[model samples]
Target: MEIIKTAIDGVVIIKPRIFTDSRGYFFESFSQREFDEKVRPIQFVQDNESKSSYGVMRGLHYQKMPYTQSKLVRCVRGRVLDVAVDIRRGSPTFGRHVAAELSEDNHLQLFIPRGFAHGFAVLSDEAVFQYKCDNFYEPQSEGGIQLIDDTLGIDWRIPTDHAILSEKDIKRTKLADTPLDFDYNEDLYKK
Candidate 1:
């Protein structure tokens, strides 16, 4: 596997080695030892999967302190415009986002550390998205910023009329109005 660093520190794009033939293909999605060596030391406690249809947009969401999560995400079927945004106040790339096309074709995985908001828009007929998280879900600590906040204009790569969003997302606050507790250079990403 090869890991590519994004503009922001600790955020990474992972490309796994794929073996393809006239018949099919094979690849090890995850290996504890290899992962520990390649990425930061993390012990993923939960694996979650979601299937969504075209035009479905989810996120710009994260959990507050004491419940923040680090994730390794990938698409197993179809495609999506995956996104991660830094919310660490003192960080150089605060409010900046990294967007990538994730699909079954490319077999890429994204590593989004704690203090980042993650979201995705389905670009295919349907998609099965999987992610491993280091922390468990905490409903009370959940928070979200508006996906269409003008400060961070993300092109979901889908027509506006085709886009579908949840009620919670529609009611989310703009980045400016959302309260944050993280500094960009906080202890979270220390080596």
Candidate 2:
């Protein structure tokens, strides 16, 4: 597996080695030992999956304090423009973001660490997305920033006029106005 770092400290893109034969291809999607060596040691406790059609924009979402989660995300079918934004106040990359393409063809994955907001927009006719989180879901601790905030300038890979969003997303605040209490630092995970 190849672990590629993003501009923001903890954001990483993972590319697993694929072996192909006459039948097809095979790869190891996750391995604890490899993870401990190539990435941070996250004890994933939950898994989630979602299916969406083109133009569907799902997030810029995170959890607060006790329920904070770091995630490893991937696309199992079709494609998408996956994104992560730093919401850690007082950090060098605060409000910064990294965007990458994940698809069935490439079979790549993105790791968005804790203290960040994550979301994705479908770039194909449809996509089946899957992810693993180091923590469990806690609806009461949910928090998010508007996916369309102009300050972040993320082009959801779909037209704003036609993009699909939930009612909750429509009222989300910008990063600057969100109630964030986390901060980013490489050493935060080192310890």
Candidate 3:
């Protein structure tokens, strides 16, 4: 696997070396040894999967301190525009974002570290998304920024009228108004 760093400090794109033959295609999707050496060491505790249709937008979400999560995500059945936003208050890249397209053909994975907000938008008719999280989810610690916040300049790749969102997502506050708990100087990876 090749670990490609993104504009932000810890976010990255992982491309697997795939082999194809008469039978089919094969690739090692995840290897703990390689991941630890290539990227930062992390013990992903939970795996989550979700299925969504075109224009479905899920987040710009993160968890508060003590329950914050880092995620390795990929799209298996279709395509999606995955986004990560830096929300650390005093960081140089704060309020900035990185967007990548993940799909079945590419087999690319995005690693989003603890202090960022993560989200995705389905671009195909249907998409099956999966991710490994470093921390177990705590609903009480959930926090998010409005996906449509103009200041963030995120292009979700879905038309406003065509996008579908949950009531919870629709009610999220803008980045400036959101109560962020992560600190730029804190070492989020510390155990």
Candidate 4:
């Protein structure tokens, strides 16, 4: 796998080396040793999967403090525009984001560290997305920034009228209005 660093610190895009033959294609999706050596050493405690159709936008969400999470995400069935936004209060890249296209053909994965907000928009007719989280989810700790916040300058690819969203996501506050607790100086990887 080749790890490509993004503009934001600690965020990365991983490309797997795939082998193809007349039979089919094969690749190592995850390897603990290589991940530990290449990226930061962390243990993902939970795995989650979701299926969505075109124009469905899921988030710009995060978990606050004690329950904050780092995620490794990929789209296994179709295509999606995956995004990660830096939300730490004092970081240089705060409010900035990195967007990458993940699909079955590319086999690319995006790693979003704890202090950022994560989300995705389905670009194909249907998409099956999976993610490994370093922490178990806590509903009470859930927080999010409105996906349509103009200040963030996100291009979700779906027209405003065509985009679909849940009531929860629709009610999320803008980045500036959302209260953030992450400190850039804090080592989020510390156990």
Task: Note the residue pairs that clash in candidate 4.
Answer: none
Candidate 2, residue 145: Cα displacement in angstroms equals: 0.5
lDDT of 2 by residue, 27-72 (tens): 9999988997889877899999999999999998998886888999
How would you encode candidate 3's per-residue C-alpha lDDT over 1-191 as one tens digit per residue?
99999999899999999999999999999999999999988999999999999999999889999899999999999999999999998999999999999999999999999999999999999999999999999999999989999999988889999999999999999999998888899998787
TM-score of 4: 0.99
Clashing pairs for predicted structure model 3, backbone only: none
Model 3 sits at a Cα RMSD from the real structure of 0.6
Clashing pairs in 1: 90-184, 91-184
Of 2 and 3, the candidate ranking higher by TM-score: 3
Better of 1 and 2 by lDDT: 1
TM-score of each: 0.96, 0.96, 0.99, 0.99
List clash counts for every candidate, in order: 2, 0, 0, 0
TM-score for model 3? 0.99
All predictions: root-mean-square deviation over Cα?
A: 1.6, 1.7, 0.6, 0.6
Looking at model 2, residue 189 earns an lDDT score of 41
Ten contiguous residues minimizing lDDT sum, candidate 4 = 182-191
